[model samples]
Target chain A: MPIIINLDVMMAKRKMSLNELSEKVGITLSNLSILKTGKAKAIRFSTLESICEVLDCQPGDLLEFHNKE
Target chain B: MKTQTILNIMFFLAWFVFIALLIKAGTILTTFSISWFNDMAAEKMYFDLDLSMYKSYSPIHYSLIVINKVILITAQAYVALLMTELLKGFNLKNPFNHLTVRLMEKICFSILVIWVMSIIHNAHLKALEKSVGLSAEYLDGSYLLWSALVYVLAQVFKRGVEIQTENQYTI
Candidate 1:
């Protein structure tokens, strides 16, 4: 859970809606929603690559780590 | 296709066993009640398992044995019914799910209950054998092991469900 998906931020910066990003990345809207909401257990490398290509960003731009008590 | 056919056959067999066990329990219980009015009814009970001699020796033990047998048969019948439900929901595509897991647990628990009841019934018979002229021949020691195996399988199936869910959610 510490590794967070900042998919919404990347999508916003790229002026891309969730639906647009999902279409460009060839992923389902529900799956994109899951990633955006940080509910997915894992993101495949191919899927990440697709998302990064669509959003014009690196994996680091869509992911973050934080230590919390 | 072969697996589906086999599962269907097993499902039918489970229903058969369930009905058979229910009829057996019903017949024994009816005979038990009738014996109070017609003592000879106990002499020609279902399964040809005459209890007249045991009744002559001790009516309490006779009733106890009959009741125990009826309960054991009924519980086993319940397990069969649970098995039918389990097989009914058998999804070869998504075999590991919540319903199957719960039904498998129920089957295991019911079998365990039957096993414990059989143990007690056999011990009771053993204690009364010297006077009754009948040794305990009904104790199937395999029920305990079978129940344990089912319980383990249920747990494994539970793990399978977890892993499958995780996989499904791993988009």
Candidate 2:
């Protein structure tokens, strides 16, 4: 719950839509949506690598840890 | 030979056992009900155990013995029904889920209750043995071990559900 997904921010910086990134990364729209909405529990390294390569962003840019308390 | 075929076979088998248990429970119930009005009805078939001696001993004890058998058999039948339900909702692709885990827990608790009830049934019969010339043969106490095994499996299934959920969320 403390982890935040910055997928949307990176996608916006890259000026890419969810469908475009999904097609490029070979991931499904629903999965990308989960990552975009921060609903994903964990991302596989292979998937993260694909997303990074597609969006031209580091994994750190897509994920962040924020303390709630 | 496929897993789905095996599961389908098990599902049908569970239903078969459930119906068989239901019929047995119903027969014993009918026998007990009839015995209430007619003493001769006590000497009947399908009870697995001949408990008619208690009928001459006392009406209350007779009723207790027959009723206990009914409850235990019905409970066993209920477990079979749950097993059928569990297999009914099971999906091979998504075997780990909340519903499956919940059903496993329910089965575990039901078996535990049966085990506890069996122990009590045996103890009560043991106390009455000398007075009624009861046989040493009693309900098997192995259900305790069975319930324990089911409880452990349910815990493992709960963990499987968590892992599957995490895997589904993984992108």
Top lDDT hit: 1
lDDT per residue as tens, model 1, B33-108: 9998999989878867788877778889889999999999999999999999999999999999999999999999
Every candidate's lDDT: 0.89, 0.86
- Docking quality level of the chain pair in candidate 2: high
Q: After superposition, how far is residue A15 of candidate 1 from its true place, in Å?
A: 1.4
Cα deviation at B165, candidate 2, in Å, is 1.4
State the local distance difference test value for candidate 1: 0.89
Worst 10 residues of 1 chain B by lDDT: B130-139
lDDT of 2 by residue, B68-104 (tens): 8788889999999999999999998888888888988
User: DockQ values for all predictions?
Assistant: 0.84, 0.91
**CAPRI tier for the interface of model 1:** high
Every candidate's CA RMSD: 1.4, 1.9
Q: Which residue pairs overlap in candidate 2's backbone? A: none
Give candidate 2 regions above 4 Å deviation: B45-48
